[model samples]
Target: MKANETIIVEEQLSAPISVVWDAITNLNSMKKWFFNNIPSFKSEVGFKTQFNVKSEERNFLHLWEIIEVVPSKKIVYNWKYAEYSGNSLVYFELFENINNTTKIKLTCKITESFSDDIPEFKTESCRGGWNYFIKQNLKNYLENS
Candidate 1:
């Protein structure tokens, strides 16, 4: 079981806090960069959604429930896999910067142990995934839009 690890990824987006906040909270904006198959999403607490992501010939049913929201400042959610053993809390925080930019800090803390047989559940793999989404995808999406 690999559930004691915590991964934190930070990025400075070339957009204001409002823009960054909308990108993370708005379902339409999320589809463009986060997950296109997400049927529904909301920033309000207690909202739950599930979607399947196929990778490496495996089906991962992602379960997410919003746990906290502070408008444009911070949002936290529970992230887990329906068929997996581990559960984690993901926090997205935004800080306004000069020149209409926003600095985002993403923290993923594992609250329960994950099965070790899955390669994607490794700490490094999870870290890489977060970096890819935040650094490559989200950064480019907000910068260009």
Candidate 2:
């Protein structure tokens, strides 16, 4: 992906903002729907974690560092891959609406160019991945959990 390219996916979930916040910030909840191999996670700024995700025939060594947090409102982090040349900033914002529905907005901006040879690094691939995680995976998880 090119530097500064951004992809966003927003979903209104049938859960409270607190629940959504927990789903994103809590390690157990995250493992349920996000990444199962996340060894450890903390919402505190500067906290860092690394894990490997195998997709198709490639292994991506995922790296992340928490950059900011606002309790149940927002969380920001820097995401990258140890084997790739790129940097991305991810922002998750939550809003509580009527009837306990919560709006979850996820924005991923490529702060630095990613290796273009990988199919998963394409813009559409990234967009589809985010949509699956937010609108489908997380949404189904929050509604059914």
TM-score of every model versus the real structure: 0.97, 0.98
Residue 83 local lDDT, model 1: 86
TM-score of 2: 0.98
Q: Model 2, range 37-108, lDDT digits (tens) per residue?
A: 999999999999999999988999999999999999999999999988999999999999999889999999
- lDDT by residue (1-145, candidate 1, tens digit) is 3566789999989999999999999999999999999999999999999999999889999999999999999999999999878999999999999999999999999999888789998888899999999999999999889
Query: Which sections of candidate 2 miss by over 4 Å?
Result: none
lDDT at 140 for candidate 2?
92
Best by lDDT: 2
Clashing pairs in 1: none
CA error at residue 20 for candidate 2, angstroms: 0.4
Off by over 4 Å in 1: none
